[model samples]
Target: MPPADIDIERATTDDLEAVADAWVRLARNQANHGSHVLADPNRETMLATLGAYQVDGGLLVARDRETVVGFASVTVERGSLALDCTRGLLSNLYVEPEYRGRGIGTALLEAAEDELRGRGVDICTLEAMAENESARRFYRQAGYDSFRIGFERTL
Candidate 1:
């Protein structure tokens, strides 16, 4: 599909279910790449959060003619101690596997950034599972550098 075919816009109450479904798929897929999140078990929590996103205007959905094929969640966060400016968090960005390479993900990402920038956010942060090299590469190519690294050791 052409990039023009996809519409990126803020999610609505009507889009909550579709957005939640995409988020579940994203979390489940991340498990294969070192994520510890229990996607299925968190469905209720995720759904609740989507409701909040809707009201906050922080959730975006990418639709290919009324079917949501991708979505991104962006939120503003207050800095913790020592920091002066607020930050934008790109908490979620996912494009369906079949929609890969169609530029939908890039469109979603750019829209998310623009949403943040419009809110006066100058810096943004996102996370990609360390084992998900493809996601890491995609973010890198989009001009995001490694600002922090997390290390974990399971007991």
Candidate 2:
């Protein structure tokens, strides 16, 4: 099937439910390796989180017709080790499983980059599980170069 037509736009208050559902699906997919299971976030939490993104001017959504097919959230933060004064963090980037490999993720990332650029972000950064080679490859193709390795241990 041809890729579904996607429309990228700013997420509104009314999009909270769809955004929350998308987050759940994406989180589950990301944690599919038996690493950990995340708790389902409540609608209020979703609203607050998205509200923060809006306040920071960093939320964008991709829609297929009236349904939200994908979304991304970018945040600007001060750089420590990097020479750049500020960098954009891809806090979240997700597309519905049915919508995967259909350019929706790419479009969402591009929209995020554009939004960050307009906000004076010099670099874009994101983290993917080391086991998720596909996500790593996608980011690499999207022009992201890994600068540091992350280590985590569960207590």
Per-residue lDDT of model 1, residues 27-49, tens digit only: 99999998999998998899999
Structure candidate 1, residue pairs in collision: none
lDDT of 2 by residue, 33-63 (tens): 4336473744457667877886666878888
- How do the predictions measure up, each by TM-score? 0.95, 0.85
TM-score of 2: 0.85
Worst 10 residues of 1 by lDDT: 77-86
lDDT values for all models: 0.90, 0.79
Identify the runs in model 2 with alpha carbons over 4 angstroms from their true place: 1-4, 34-37, 41-44, 78-83
RMSD of each: 1.5, 3.0
Error (Å) of candidate 2 at residue 127 is 1.0
